[model samples]
Target: KIETIDVTPLNNEQSIQASLKAFAQFNRDPYQDPGTVMRHPGLLFLSEIGEVKQQVEHINALKDELVTRMHTLNARARNTHVKMAWRGVSALQLYRHITAVDYAPRKALFSWEGRTTSISRPHSKEEFIEIILKTKDMCPAHVSPLDWDDILRKEILYIQSVQENGDLVRMKPVAPHPRLLLYKTTDVKATDTIFSNVPTFVKTAPDCTIVELTSFDFSKTTTRRKKRVFIPIVERLNMYFRPFK
Candidate 1:
């Protein structure tokens, strides 16, 4: 699991000190239990640490090292077919002790028909708490959102009772996975999203040729479809450009 990764192997002492220095500048006061903040439950401090101009150079250097380490890991694992698609700058996230987070299952974002579902979108901590509390009674006719939410909450609480610093968490693509973070101490970590492409296979009917099609869903309606010729594994399509160097 990514969470079990010992970042010590990937980062050097200089980079670690730089990250700690940046955190110190951002969080001047001594660590406090985020649970004490009645206004926000889990979050103590959240911001793009790169915005600190004084430490921007050091931060970027650290980020580059991390990205390079990812590529190194891929190569070491013989996953040369996989390539980094995109990555974002690291954001500093500080959580208080005893902090708990209930991440919505990835599948909840879509429906059984593979369409995006219209679920409650909470923008703030207060709003999120309200939504969770009200989910039990909201009881929409289509699905029971409460059952899964309750189960995930309990499971997270039970499984992840403690998380230390430098631990990384990876979320799988297009799967319904839940995570809970119960910080034993003031938690500080750099978070970023790295999208990667790996070799994949598409299964099709034995006798039928697979064709590619594009469609857009607007106002809950799919617009006109545009069909494209399917390129087989052995054949290369000229339509797409080569991956960037």
Candidate 2:
């Protein structure tokens, strides 16, 4: 069975102290990645602190390994469980794992040269919309109908596609938009969908942080061994993107 390791303790004691002391040199830059820490002089000095060089090196190496594993676990935890149908085929249950935290919003910047010069405000709708568009291009799904006329036309076309080609075409399944498209897909009885409460990003448009995570299951008998998919983070942000009640 897969298990989870409580990583909070990993950040609790002396290890965390070392990390902080090293990070202090960088003024605790919120955007610093693991590579940034390695290149920083203060962090490198931890290994040369008196006779702790060799031991510190070993600990650091282990920490790196632990961090990699933790990333995988975090990705799995953020995974979405849902049923996806392609071209009217039987819906395939999938565990969609959304990775790359760097894609998330940056922390509020509150200082500059020891003086607060700028502050983070809710990001603009255009930024979120851009992200959404890029995500849709990557996931590309059939255009969802907006009104009854559109729906009726799409339904009719869907039938014609099957009759003409003996398969679904034109009216096809598109990549999920997380916020809008997913609800319709899971509006079925076969799959149990769950959306967790987690802030993917903070939005300035509505002055509220968007907090919601979608989860899905993985199949052990699927024909595809491995697949990579991207989830549009803006779908959630759009929920709080202002102008909407």
Candidate 3:
């Protein structure tokens, strides 16, 4: 199973992510436990609405303090550009300003599938992966092949995608890139639905870099369809991979 979302640290939205992290934890028996999800699946800090409004003030202050506390960490990296690959829909490696994130607390209550699901986190990455595998692919009506052994053996890669408009997008920086995997999302997932619907490519072909995605949810509950629609993000994509010298 594959799922993706922008995970950034901003003091105010921690609760929202706490809710997601909770889902990440309760994902195993989400249908069974509504109470645990209410508490937290993992460690989560609590924040009041007024606290959210003051986040910007706190962040600016942290920046000033960091100027001295960690000035010796890695000065050389300031001028160096690191290269990473995006295996979902684009071969282009995004040039991002890498920096430390400031985390915030998760609010107590939120909505999921029209029902309120609380914030909690999985204790370990292994546990997180388990739920991601189960929740991202399976549905009340049908299930995709998220439990295949062959798929598990492949290296897990994270692809970030951005839709510029209706037709264009950018994908890349596939963290933990498979020694090879096409740019298509389905290819990484190795699922039959994406294989049957999306264009095909063997290994990590450049052609697979900028995939023309076709959504495959014509027959699921409205609540279910929504759950599946947002996933497997693409880092970046372009009609042309800018030639660099």
Model number with the top lDDT:
1
Q: What is candidate 1's CA lDDT for residue 26?
A: 22
lDDT of 2 by residue, 91-171 (tens): 111111111111112222111111111112344434333434444333214554344345444433433332221211111
TM-score of each: 0.18, 0.19, 0.17
Off by over 4 Å in 2: 1-20, 23-39, 42-50, 74-134, 137-245
**What tens digits encode model 3's per-residue C-alpha lDDT throughout 1-245?**
11321222223366455444433231224243221212221122232334433553464465456544435545344223211221121111111111111232111111112111122221233433343355443333443455443343231222113222222212222211111112224333522221111111122222222322222222321322222112222221111111112
Whole-model lDDT, model 1: 0.27
Model 1 CA lDDT for position 97: 17
For residue 164, give model 2's deviation from the true position in Å: 32
Q: State which candidate, 2 or 3, has the greater TM-score.
A: 2
User: Which candidate comes out best when scored by TM-score?
Assistant: 2
Model 2: worst 10 consecutive residues (lDDT sum): 110-119
- Candidate 3 stretches greater than 4 Å from native: 1-51, 63-72, 75-172, 175-245
User: What would the per-residue lDDT of candidate 1 be over residues 36-100, giving only the tens digit for each residue?
Assistant: 12111111122332233334455456656655666666443523323223222111222211211
Q: Is candidate 1 or candidate 3 better by lDDT?
A: 1
Q: Give model 2's TM-score versus the native structure.
A: 0.19
Kindly indicate the candidate among 1 and 2 with the higher TM-score: 2
